[model samples]
Structure formats: C-alpha cells, structure tokens
Target: RFNQFFSFFSRIDTLGLNNFIDPRGYVQIQQIMENMTINRLEIRVDSLYMDLQIQILGLCRKNNIRNVVITVNPGGMIDQFRNKLCTESEFGVTLDVCERIGNVEGAYFGQWRRFWNEMDVYLRKKGIKMQMNLCNDNGFDHDGYARCGVRSHIRCERMDRQNMGVIRPISLSRGFLPK
Candidate 1:
C-alpha cells in the first residue's frame, strides 16, 4: 500500500521526514524510498540516535538522494556523523538549538551553550551552512538565536528603528526543484 501510494509520484524529489518514528515508520520509509524517486532529502530529528541515523543513511543510499540535509540536535560527533552519512556532494548536518527544553538537567538544551559552541566549530570545519527554523520553543529567549548555530538568524532587536531591510535575504521556496 505504501509503495502504491508513492508510485503515483515517480518524479517527486526533495523529501522531508520527521524524527522519532516507530519501527513501522521505518518500514514505511524504506518502502517509500524503494518505490518513489527522491533527490534532495531532509531528515529532521531530535537527537542523532544511531538507529535512526543508520536507517536514514541506508535509505538515502538506496534511493541515491543527491542533496541530503540531516538536522538533528547539537551533540553528535562531527567526524562520526560525516563519515556515516555525508558524501562529496551537498550534505549538511545542522544543530537544532533546542527541542522542548524538558527536564532541564536531562535534555539537550540543558547544556545549550556548550552544544552551540561545539556545533559552530563542527559546521565550519565541514563547510556546511546551517539554517534555523525557529518554531518558538515555548517562550524561549530570542537573544541566543544568533549564537545557536543559525546561518540566518531572525533579529527583532531593532523593530522600532526605521528601515530594518529584508529579514531573510534569500528565498527558501523550492521553485527550481522537480515536483
């Protein structure tokens, strides 16, 4: 059934999937990859779990995804992740600064400052740019947005001033990519 659904759109590219999927979700993803045709794929997950990492990498390989972007929380080893998933082409591993910030001492954002600092260095070393989609993590402060591994930071500091100019200069819309 999964295969049949995706088979309808053989020309589709630029696939995106969520993180923390169940075992059945993995199976469905596998089937979708096998059935559909994808090039640019973005796998957004909470943390870089080895299990999901391996699964996503495997699917990308099998489908021959060209521009693969894996956005996970900032903690995983750069070398290890790059070796496991990245290739010579356009591959990026961005640090999503915060998730829910649940249980401050236990979550990734617990060591938020540390995570961003490390991720900045890692991304710089790999020459992979980062993009932040600030979904407003429950009244989290925006002051740290610039420091938290975001390539395009949203600044609301000078709202009162005249002529702030374009917020995000670039166009994120996928106009050129295949449907």
Candidate 2:
C-alpha cells in the first residue's frame, strides 16, 4: 500500500502530505527515487512532532534532498519542535519552513511578531531565508490597498513615529504594492 503511494509520488517533483502520516510511508517514498528526483517537499502539520519530523529529516539527508518546506499551525509548540530538529540534525539540508499562527481575538500578536522577526534574523544569519505569513483581519490587507502607491506623507510619518526606531524609511509608495 505504501509502495503504491510512493510510486504515485515518484512521478511528481512536488508532494504535499499531512503531518500525521506514518514515518514508514515517507521512508518508502525515499526508497523509490531510482530514476526520479524530487526538488521540493512540502509538509503541512498541525503541530511539529520531533520524532516524526526527525524521521523525515533523516530521509531527506539520505536522499540528498535539496529543498524542504514545512508549515505548522499556531501555538509555540511546533516552532519549538522545529528549532529542536534543526539543532539536532547536523546534516545540511536547506529547509524553508513557514509557521502560520492562528488569529484569535485578544491574542498576543506582538509576541508572535517578535518571535517571527527573530526567527527571520536567525535564519538570515545561517544563510537561510525563512518566510512567515501572519494573517489577521486588521493586519493583512489582501486587496493591496495599504500596499498601494497612494500613501500619504502624514500616514507615513505617523507610522514612522508609531514604530519609532523599528520601521525604516523606504519608497513605500513605489514598492509596497506587489505586481
């Protein structure tokens, strides 16, 4: 059964799987790389499980895996486990993990923001770039209105003053909106 699943994945370069999948299932996938190569592996987990994540990491190491993407939901548990795995594994596998924290009313958004910022700096230090997406009703403007080139100087100054020394001055009007 596992082999069949692996066979199916063998034909594709990208594979997405849930976090609670059996470790043996991943191992079987690793075994079937006879003629195929997987460039990217994405795993979405409810929370990070050290043992299971380590098993996946081991497979990646053995298979000469190049890129890995892991996504874990809210709470610090998954982030903690991910840090542990990175620390424990000596094998160099470039990993780009994204952890999305749920937006709950009155939640500690400041803390999570700081945590993600620190994580980014840490990864940058290690020559790895980690992308974090924090979504909240107020924070995320999916319509790109806030990011548009119509920013007023008053608003920019207000934001600068509010952010103090944290927010850097840039050409926000030109580059804020994504094409």
What are the models' TM-scores? 0.48, 0.52
TM-score of 2: 0.52
- What is the TM-score of candidate 1? 0.48
> How many clashes show up per model?
0, 0
**Worst 10 contiguous positions by lDDT, candidate 1:** 170-179
lDDT by candidate, in order shown: 0.43, 0.45
Model 1's C-alpha root-mean-square deviation from the true structure amounts to 9.9
lDDT of 2: 0.45
For residues 66-141, write the lDDT of model 1, one tens digit per residue: 4555444444323344345433323322222223223333224324445545644555465544332333444433
Model 2 stretches with alpha carbons more than 4 Å out: 1-11, 32-36, 76-96, 99-101, 105-111, 136-179
Which residue pairs does candidate 1 place in steric collision?
Answer: none
lDDT of 1: 0.43
- Among the numbered candidates, top lDDT falls to 2
